[model samples]
Target: MESISITPTIINPKRVFKKTTGEEWYNYYAGFSDDFVSEILNSFELPKDSVILDPWNGGGTTTLNCALAGYNVIGIDLNPVMNIVAKSKFCNTDDVLMALDIVKYLRVNNYPNKLNDESDFLLNWFDYNTASYIRYISFSLQNKCNTILNSKVFSLIFLALFKLVRKYIGKFIPSNPTWVKKAKNSNDKISIESTKIKIDLKNILREKLSATFVDNVSSIGKERFYCASSTKLPLKEHSVDAVITSPPYCTRIDYGIATSPELAVLLGNHPAEIDNIRRTLTGRTTIDKSFLEIESLGLTAKKMLLEIFNHQSHASVSYYYKNFAQYFIDINESLKQIKKVLKRNGYFACVVQDSHYKEIYCDLALIFTEMAEENGLSLIHRQDFMSKFVMANINSKVKKYRDKITANETVLIFQAN
Candidate 1:
């Protein structure tokens, strides 16, 4: 395949959806399309034995895609729930039937009436009946002493079912609500019958997992997954052949808080554990105030921070940029580590977007590219992709808030010199 030029015009988010199957699962913003990954790998001319690394592997998209492309892959994420998900998707298995059987056993035998008193968040978010049922299933699976070959299968089923239940029953609000006050007054209603919702959810899980497993068995190559911070990867120096990842944006999306309920249900963690989980995450709301000192170290960062502060309130801008700045510094450090491990002339591909903070556009991709160049990497290609999904609806006041930020994202490619 001819290598494409890196430019902002190459990315068409609308086209991404148009090219996909249009399935509900494919529509998920957090999940990457398999076709997109394949295209990226082909463009890179990845060797069959190339070792690929995805530092922020969300939903196992990059890891699984690498496996399908005949490359050895290592995926790292801070979320243990995602670790389970990635493992289930990448690990090869001979007998999916056994996995389904294990799920059946769990479904029949597990039913806890009382949760640990420590789970206040779970109790708050989930009605007792729903909580107990989910707990029973999770407990049964957890107590299974044997490392059942179908553990991943069960986990996928649980995750898929959890999503379905949330969607149908309106168990929680969407992760980002630009205008919470207006949303409350809208005509939308939280509605879904519990029993019907559960059955529908279970059926979808069984179907999706069954199809996914069948596809996985037919694919080639081996893949590995890890649960750790990307800034501190466990791999040895010069071990990987390439790097491909899409780091989180600086848009103050509290991923941990947004997904807290889901993680709690998946891990069966008590409510008390939720706070610990959120606190451990890296992003806008999670970071402490002391990180602002980095401004003295990087001129570009100082300029970006100043711009952010100029448009948004100082407190809000600081709240968003504190962690993002750290994330950049961490990425710079990670790239140094990446340079050590990656083979000479190895490729580094990143899909990133310029995000806004109250209309103040922060060119994070450009900033990171400059940082990477300073750390001994050379920028080879930069492409801008259009993100069609409006961050905030036009008529809403949130759009006015976001217009102060950025409107689009970009993808950049770098190479080890």
Candidate 2:
């Protein structure tokens, strides 16, 4: 038998992952593809029973891929919707057709005239008719009981159409640049047909759910997942065999604020509740200046924090950096716990990118490498990967700000000595 060597390619920072059919399955938040995860696993020579943990398992990519690879996997995230998404994506189902039937039924009969008045945030983002239709679909699925299979299928459907109601709407003013802004509207009479939208949403949901259903069923084994904060995972010291994750970029991307509007709508949370959610999120833009001062410990981290602090006339840079610094501190603490749980000689593969704060660049991979070394992990290999997906759009003023920083991303690999 011939031995096949596996080499992990360093991606170009300026290159974007080519879009495939499954691309839309993630709604632009697909953190990594299955091939990427598989390559990482192969490089590590991961054991079949190795316990894998992804601290920031956005959209369940790592969890699902790890499970299918026949490893015991645990995923942790602060976002409730992500928890739902992970669960739905990994839970096994016997019949996707039944799930499609449920969606079809809901689409036909659950068209409510109005949502509860308490849902002001939902009303603000979605037109009245669209909001009503979504409310009906959501209400129909609430508390419906079934096997893990049915539940996950329903979740996929709900999650797929979660943003359909407001897909073409205009951007919301005073939004965070890190998050995708809603489109702004110039006219009041935008021709949005409620029935057509619902039908299209239903069809898309069914097709996606069916594909995921077939793929998961065809797989021979399963993986486990956890819906919790990585900062405080449930694992014991030195228990895991490997850790692979890409922590959120510093203050550059606010996960909660970006996804809050959709979360608020799906969860039927009030505006007040949404505000509270935003506050609890790690990368939120609501942090006070005092928090920013506290985060200015790391030289680069502090420098960027101060720059944002000085330029307070435009955006709330302080709040972003403060939250970002908090996230880094949390990651450091979590890595310490991970060390305790990882077995001797275990490996940690981190996929991270450098981010811009004001005009300064923060090399997060390098910072984490130092932090991990301080905590008994040794730096073994560092590979640079190109991520064509630049955070700031080309023509935006922010582009000039980012131009001051490097335009590439890197991935670092570390091992426990």
Of the candidates shown, which would achieve the greatest TM-score relative to the real structure? 1
- lDDT score of residue 391 within candidate 1: 54
Q: What local lDDT does model 1 show for residue 100?
A: 49
Clashes of each: 17, 20
lDDT for each candidate structure: 0.60, 0.61
After superposition, candidate 2 runs with Cα above 4 Å error:
1-23, 91-94, 107-114, 145-150, 166-198, 213-220, 288-324, 386-388, 393-395, 398-406
lDDT tens string, model 1, 1-417? 123343322233222444221223322355445655666677777678888888888767778778877788888877766666666664223334445465554443334554766443444455555556666656666666333223555555556555664554343454443212111322333333445545665566555543453253454666776667766888987788778777766565666755654566655556556566565554535776454456433566667766755654656565555665666566666667677777777777777767655665677777777777877678987767666564544436666565442356666777777
Residue 70 in model 1: lDDT = 73
lDDT of 2: 0.61
lDDT score for residue 301 of model 1 = 63
C-alpha RMSD in Å of predicted model 2 compared with the true structure: 4.9
TM-score attained by model 1: 0.80
TM per candidate comes to 0.80, 0.79
In order, what is each prediction's RMSD in angstroms? 4.9, 4.9
